[model samples]
Target: MRILQPHTRPADEAAARRIQDELRARAEPFGPGPERVRTIAGVDVAYAGAAGAADDQLAAAIVVLDAFTLEVVDSAVAVGRAEFPYVPGLFAFRELPTVLDALERLDTVPDLVLCDGHGVAHPRRFGLACHLGVLTGLPTAGVGKTRLVGEHAEPGAAPGDGADLVHEGEVVGRVLRTQRGVKPVYVSAGHRIGLDAACRHVLATAPRYRLPETTRQADALCRQALREAGTESGSPALS
Candidate 1:
């Protein structure tokens, strides 16, 4: 996929923030996205070691699945050394290059992308999900394992129960219970999707686990990619 807005990689945190602020406006964070979703892509990144280490290699994976069946249809992985330092609210800069590379390698572009991170449920309201959506103009949502910035009551102990994740007096996402008694996952609109639809998609995707199938599959694939990288080199990526 050709990037329409090719930009120089930022050199510092300040530059990264400016980029985020500028691109945040381009993200369409409140649409229904595709009406009949057929395929959903799950994206995740794995670190070779500690995020700040010199040998900090990164593996980005994209797994495209049939939305109804939740079977993997296509997949891709990009492996490279980390190019940026770990900065809170600026992680997109670190993972995006490889993510884009992996996306480009995919045989198909999915109708929706389910990211293993936050979207509008972020301090800047432009997490990895938002960044990827804005960059690719794809419908995307974030399914975070933990809240990045929000406060909310615990949801009911039933599958599909949810509570609003409010941040700064605004509903930024949903704390959704995909299983009857498991902990909830945070769901947020990335781009071209609304909070309600994002939550629905989450529940549908996470039929049998705390995390969505997209995240679970992509996470496993990226971790495997990292392990493969370790085998190619004498030193392991993670200690």
Candidate 2:
């Protein structure tokens, strides 16, 4: 896979914020994205040292899957040290470098990407999914296990039920129930996608689990990659 829009690494929190501010303008939060989606990719990162430590090892993984079958078609992993400090709302800076490396190693470029984090439902409306979508110029969305921003009522117990996730007087995402009676996941548009489409995709990809198959597979792969890199399991800093 090739990156359509490469970006520079931020030297500090200020620079990272500036980058987000600049790129945030390019994100298309309201969209009808990928009508005929055939493939989807899930991206995740795992840590192998104390959080915020410069020496902390990072493992980034991207797993492309058949949209209908949910079978992995291609996958890649990259292991490296964290390049920037861990700052709230700017976690993308800490993981994107290694994630890009892994993306470049992939043999397939997916029709859409699903990040294991927030997107427009972030403090700056530019979380990992938005950042990665803009940089790669790919249609992307986020399906986060935990809320990063916004407030919402609990969705219904049935799968596919959802509620608006509102922030600052605007609907930024959705609280979606992918599995019946399971905890809901946060779904948000990253780039070139809308919240409705994003939620639809998430539900489609997560037929049998609380989390999407893409996320679960990518998460497992990143952890395995970290272990193969000879590091003990460490808590993930972001996703």
Clashing pairs in 2: none
Output the worst ten-in-a-row residue range by lDDT, candidate 1: 1-10
Candidate 1 scores a C-alpha RMSD against the true structure in Å of: 2.8
Alpha-carbon lDDT of model 2: 0.90
- Model 2 TM-score is 0.94
lDDT of 1 by residue, 1-239 (tens): 55555544877788888889999999988977798999988999999766875337899999988999999999999998767877667777888888988888988879999998889999999998999898888999989888889899999899999999999999999999999878888999999998888888888888999988888899999999989988886665696
Cα-based lDDT at residue 71, candidate 1: 99
* TM-score attained by model 1: 0.93
- Give the root-mean-square deviation of each candidate in angstroms: 2.8, 4.6
Query: Candidate 2 residues 1-239, lDDT tens each?
Result: 89988768887788889999999998887788987899999999999867787558889999999999999999999999888878779888888889999999999889999998999999999999999999999999988889988899989889999999999999999999988878899999999989988888898899999998998999999999988877445555576
- Separately for all candidates shown, the number of backbone clashes (residues 3 or more apart, or on different chains) is 2, 0
